[model samples]
Target: MEYRIEKDLLGEIKVPKEAYYGIHTVRACNNFPVSGLRTHPALIRAIARVKQAAALANMSAGLLDRRVGDAICRAAEEVAGGGLADQFIVDPFQGGAGTSTNMNVNEVIANRAIELLGGQKGDYRLVHPLEHVNLSQSTNDVYPTALRVAAIGMVLELSDCLAGLQAAFQEKEAEFAGILKVGRTEMQDAVPVTLGQEFSAFAEGIARDRWRLYKVEERLRQVNLGGTAVGTGLNADPKYIYAVIEELRAITGYGLARAENTVDLTQNADVFVEVSGLLKAAAVNLSKIAGDLRLLSSGPLGGLAELKLPQVQPGSSIMPGKVNPVIPEMVTQVAFQVMGNDQVIAMAAAAGQLELNAFMPLIAHNLLQSLELLINAVNIFSEKCVKGIKADEERCRRWLEESHSFITALTPHLGYDRAAELVKKAMAEKRLLREVIIESGLFTAGELELIFTPGELTRPGVAGAKLLEKKG
Candidate 1:
């Protein structure tokens, strides 16, 4: 490919003639090739929006020429609208605390702007990247603000996915309302609970996750877009600072506000930690739910066998007719990944130095990945797994009757000692609690049927007490 020479402070470098990215991006590619992953598309669009807003704000402040601002805004819009996506080539892991990312965007926008103005791509004379496109902006302000924007968008998407997942569980809850199953604590049968009740708990967890994820937007909406360098608004004018956020709000349609204390917003990375912590909490819930699904669906012949997940594929190469709970397993793995990303985000946020966090790139990368992964995983789980689950009503009934734990529910009617003695007798005889209770002749099968109704089985506190009261 034909190449063009671009000069920076570190001398001349050759860039592809057709490439919008220039010297800084090339240097970044060379310096940080650790992860071949490029910056997230959401973040790239967010940065373009920041650049567009800065142009409009600077032009309003009379600091940028109208012609230059117009050209830059047009080019920035192209990038923001999803054009020139391949031009953002910098790796997610880079030095200078996202300066490489900022310059990559700047160079691409400047070159594209130059072309729009009927000038050659390398003609910085028409649209200089740093002098015109990035006027009144700093990496410190631009990068973090863009991260906030992208994160808010991702969080909204994740909330929607969570809502869908919750609905899936709600549907299953209604479907399995009549399935009486044995509940276990510490791998031992504890009590009888309807399969619907178990699914209702899953739905409740996802509902909580959705609400918590939605609230993160409130924290992310406050940003330091014009607090150039160190958040003191040192190089950026006050008018530009105020106008920039307004332009950003209008462009992105987010309820964004400039932080009252830009320095605090700039220097501290605690918000990212808080966001990651919330993500970790969501991950925890997802992991637990996934594990429970796996456990419930564990065996067609040898395990709990209480649930049957949709068989999307064959499970084993060696075993015949084997199918697995692959979707919940997938959800479990994604949860692990999100949880790991949270740790990375937490540590990166805490590793920032004074005046400016030098680890913003690391934090942004992990946080964004976590959001994207969760959005996709939760949606897939809802669509493919939760929606397709089938409860084995017969199996549920058998397990509930076989376990002595069901005797606990009869304790209010039978005295505690009698219940305990009956449990031992049932175990010793290898008979079901229902059989032993029937033999005792304290109540008929018809009375036991009324006592163990679906609502009565799972409802909290003294479930069958009224049966004995009526008998008295």
Candidate 2:
């Protein structure tokens, strides 16, 4: 293996001759080995876009030569297009408020631009990482801006996934629209409801999440790119400060705007906290819906067998023919992980001090991770679980027939006291409520049959009251 000497403030080190990264990135690679996980590719692409935008902004403001800006733009575009993702070797969990990641991008772009300009690698005279590529920007601003871009992209993807999942639920609702099942409260039977209504509730919950995720993009669109180090636009040309964001908007095609209060934006990480809170809300809803599906599909014989989830794999190594709700179980675990990541984001956001948040790396890492996880989880859940779910009509009907809760339908016809006595007697004898009603002689068989029909029992109002009066 051949090596080239690259020098930094610390000293000189040997770098791979073919590598696009430089001394600073190599130092970061050696220094942080905490997570074994590298920075996300989406985030790296965002950083490249920021650098390209800055170079154009500088050229427009006369801060950079046209040739230098052109070379930098070409190199940054290569990075943005995912040509040099392998060059970003820094871990996601690092100190210095993501300075390592910022420097990694700078070094990669500088070396690539040097190559483009017909200059040798590590030749700062042609393309200096800090003086040329990373001019008029600080990690404090660049890192968070890139984070916002990456997060917003992921949020859009998650919204699409959620919408698909919601559609799957709606289809299931239509398929099971007339299948009657006993609703439960406190794990006990309460009343009759159509399986379709239950699926519609699931669809509504996911629809709400999709709307909330779309709104999150609005909050994330405000960035502090031109704020420089401490959000005062220090050392940054006024024209460049305004021009950079426009360049960024053109590059990203997002409604990204510079924050009005640059200093406040630099200091406070509340926007990230709000995004994390929204993610937590979605996670909570997903976990709850997954749990309900698991319960409804619990057992084939011993549990609530109203639902039969699609079986993609064989369950139980020792026990024969024991299928499990593995997909929903997997989704529930993902929700748990997203909830945990949200907590990490909150703590890191709150840990920011006066000038800038030193925990930007942590926040960026966890936020992007949660978004990716949710996207995959929702898509998988829709395809593997919700869309393939089957209704056990026989089991559901059996539960409805045995439930004493249906006696509530008789209250308006037979009066509350009489209904309560019938329910009590049914439970005491461990018999169906209709049997007790028959023996009580409260009404003729025809009237009882009319009251106990599926339409009369499930819907509101006494459709059988006229029958009762005619028979009496």
Candidate 3:
């Protein structure tokens, strides 16, 4: 519990003598106690990678002391490896467009690098945080670049999780491919469809989501790494500016490129808005599929009872024998949150004034949170719900057979007006259409039988017509 004094333009402050973070980070901790949430570890790792790339670039340009640069590189490597995660204490909701986060990384790397040089943590004479650690950078450029890097990693993870979910749905589609169920529109039975077909649609929606997630990565990979201080490159050396981006590409193994219009990249946060919109679209699809699963698996008795989601936990404490679709419910909640986060990102993106978006901390926090939540939700939904779902074959068959929508199959033969009248009469009388059709004497029983087979009814091409042609 020892301390040392570190001063900035504001004033001097006592920093823990052993803390890798120095006065600036301490100031940030005191200033922004807003969220009580720490910056994401992914973002911290990305910032450290930026610092590592900057150190290497500085050395390559002969702008830094070789021993000092080497030490800084080693410190940054450790931080990027997540060795010093506990030392990053700034809240994600801070002001100054993530300057607090940027400085927090700078101070931590500078102090640790000083230790590697056999100097005390607070010894600025050996390694100054601002002069050495923060060379050729500004929060305006570095923070957003780091955010992009972090987001790229997160998006990839979510994409993988979504792919898993899509595959789970496809597996279920195959499992239930033969189970005939009634399709509905406006809550009324319209026609017959296979349970497998419903799940195939779900998988297709998620496949589109996976494709969208992949496409947005290219947008994020265009970064303003060399555009220090409002994209003018400012006091940064030209050689360092050009070389740092290449070093960053090597460090991250991402296809990162410096922005073609650095100033526009610095001033506008619209790309994050675009990414959030795409996430919102995916959330919509997830929510819709979850809602459908909930409806299809509603009750063992009174509901559709066509699907039985894996019971993960007891649905109620007092309602005996209750098992809820908690996995899909959880995914629905995640979708709600993602939709809300998209709004936050939109407002934050629009709130940017001239040279920089002062709202980046909020944008970064919400975007990363959305990604993490979606990844977890998708993974759990696949494992706990979709993978274990079972179709009620008898229930699906009964509903499909009982529905008056079977009149659809006869429309081509009996004509639309006659089929509509037959459907109305059968539904009103609570009579099976097969019995009604047989009693009505519109077609022979053999022809009706051929037309009403599950494959002939649900699939294209009329088996009854083919039967008639062969008979002739």
> Candidate 2: deviation at residue 63, Å?
1.8
Per-residue lDDT tens digits of candidate 2, residues 1-472? 9889999878999999888899988888899988889998889999999999999999999999889889999999999999988889999889899999999999999999999999988888998999989899999889889999888899999999999999999999999988977988898888778898899999999999999999888999999998999999888999999999999999999999999988888888888888888888888989999999999998889999899999999999999999889999998999999999989988998899989999999888889989999999999999989989999999998998898866777778778888888888898999988778878887666776667666776666775776667767
Q: Which ten residues in a row have the lowest lDDT in candidate 2?
A: 443-452
TM-scores vs. true structure, each candidate: 0.98, 0.96, 0.97
Prediction RMSDs, each to the true structure:
1.2, 1.7, 1.5
- Across residues 259-374, which tens digit of lDDT does each residue of candidate 3 receive? 98899999999999999999999999999999999999988899998998888788898999988888988999999999999999999999999999999999999999999999
lDDT of 1 at 52: 98
Ranking by lDDT: 1, 3, 2
1 against 2, candidate with superior lDDT: 1
Q: Which candidate is the best by TM-score?
A: 1
lDDT for each residue of candidate 1 in 26-52, tens digit (9 for 90 to 100): 999999898789998899999999999
User: Model-by-model lDDT, in order?
Assistant: 0.91, 0.90, 0.90
Rank ordering of all candidates by TM-score, starting from the highest: 1, 3, 2
Off by over 4 Å in 2: 444-449, 453-472
Instruction: Please report the TM-score between candidate 3 and the true structure.
Output: 0.97
